[model samples]
Target: MRVLMVGWEFPPYVSGGLGTHTYELTRKMPHDVNITFFMPDRGEVSVPWMDIKRIKTSIGFGPYMTFGGSVLKESIIKSVEDYAKEVGKTAKQTDFDIVHCHDWLTVMGGICAKRENGKPLVFTVHSTEYDRSIGNPCPWVMDIERYGINEADGIIAVSKRIKEQIIEKYGADPGKIRVVYNAIDSSSFDCGLKFKPTEDLILSLGRLTLHKGIDHLLRAAKIVIEHHPSAKFVIAGKGDKFKDLVEMSIDLGIEKNVFFLGYVPQEDITKLYARADVFLMPSVFEPFGITALEAMAAGTPTIISKTSGVCEVTNNVFKIDFWDTEKMASRILEILNYKELFEEMSNNCRSEAKRITWDDIAMQTKDFYESVLR
Candidate 1:
């Protein structure tokens, strides 16, 4: 089957988990399936296995360009229109069986491609503006999301939670929505890279935003420090709440213990995972937490919030509510103080995470394509 995928950013250019998911899934897709991923002319990607097709556009296609700025509304509209026309022109020559869009950024393009090519359109919801928005989201974006849901031949949600949200928020039919869990590329994770820990490190890596619940993690950091003074918390990734989270750390008197490593490069990720004593994921509304799997795969014990979709697959990690800093702190302390418990948890997590592979994701996606075509 020939597939055209539209996404905002590809890996190496990604700001978060969405890019990672796109790269891994596409790279391992069945050899018989032909994929031509469309993105806004980013430089070369790290993975050579996937067939990536870059497109030229005037809009600033930074990682957060579509989600930010004074000209965001105009930029998104213009970008979508441009991509849609581009796809329509491409369809005149090459035939494709499906046009799949990864997020809201590419939905308009998907619609245009389907309209022009008369091929089936598939919309995958990695996240919704409702989950990411601090307050009321841009009505325009929400409207576009609803349009995609109504127009799509098939809808894929990264998690069941996102599936439920689409039905409730947009009145989407449950029968059309398919819950496909995201998988990790465990082989790409450099298990050979080893790092010696100078301090007992606690890591929380994700976009530092309100919904990610980084502030709650900071509050828990203070409590963990009170019990284990030597433990250092490394909060990685960049987002809108960077300043607020930094200030909160200072206000809570945990500045010394917390390190805000903004925008960790793709290379340094596995190193951090190997050195860290534990990984923390305190998301208020996580569709799926890929970092938890990364941590577990690296032989690092993971503690996630009960609300995370990763909890559906992860068995050994301690689960706590995002609001419960006391419980979060206690869990962190337990992982740090008790070596036997930590070792046991890490070993079990490694075994479980090994079962989740990108090859399996590709096969499931291929099956979905077959079902849709029928």
Candidate 2:
């Protein structure tokens, strides 16, 4: 089977999980299943297992918008429009069984490919506009997302929560959307020896966006510090929320307790996972939380939001509502103070991570493709 997969990010240049998903899934796919991945030419990105087509765009639209700058909505839409035109021309000439796209950014290209080649278009909803904007989504992005959702022959949602969101928000057919859970490359976390920090370290890694609920985590950190003064909270990764979150930490009087490390590199991510006492993902509405899985694979006890799609598969990690800072703090304290609880959760989560692998995910994805074709 040949798949013309359209995505925005990949390894090394990844701003978030979408890139990692595209890279890992393509890597693990069977020899018989060939992928021709299309992406913006970020830089030197190499994937030996599959063919990569890098289309250069005039505009600079990243995975997540950086802090303090207003992103012109018109520019981004124009960039996607140009990219779709390019992709459509390619799809008309190239031979492929299906057009697969990830997120809203690439769906236009996927739709174009479907139109040009008359092949089945598979739209993968890693997230929706509602998830990003926390219920107040941009109408332009929502329109594009809705159009793709309606046009696609099949849809793949990263989690059941996302599947439900598409049905509820866009009125997509429930039967057409397949729930495919995201998986981690456990070996990346397995390579390093566990390093315990002198202080109780609570880590939050991801884009510091409004929907990420980092603000809630900051509130929880203050409570955790009141009980455990020596505990430290680290917020890694960058986004438009950086300055606001910094000020919020100061206002909450947890500035000393919290350390904001802006944009940790992919190579250093595993090291952060290994050193932390606890990993927290307090997302207001996450389709799937991949960082939590990475932390688990590294044997760090994790606390995630009940709204996170990972809650569907997770058993050992503590699940709390994003707004419940009190409970979030309590869970962090319990993990830090009780060695037995920490070890059990950590070990169990690592075992759980082992069961969820890219190979298995690839097989499931391939099966889905075949089903869609039939």
Candidate achieving the largest TM-score: 2
Model 2 error, position 64 (Å): 3.5
Model 1 whole-model lDDT (C-alpha atoms) = 0.82
TM-score of each: 0.94, 0.96
- The sequence of per-residue lDDT tens digits that candidate 1 reaches over residues 278-327 is 99999998888998998888878889998878888778889999999999
Top of the candidates by lDDT:
2
- What candidate 1 gets wrong by more than 4 Å, as runs, is 44-50, 61-70, 190-198
Candidate 2 residue-wise lDDT, 186-239, digit = tens = 988964444444569999998888889999999999899999999999989888
**lDDT per model vs. reference:** 0.82, 0.88
Clashes of 1: 0
Candidate 1, which ten residues in sequence have the lowest lDDT sum? Answer: 189-198
Error of 1 at 358 (Å): 0.9
Model 1 TM-score, all chains together: 0.94
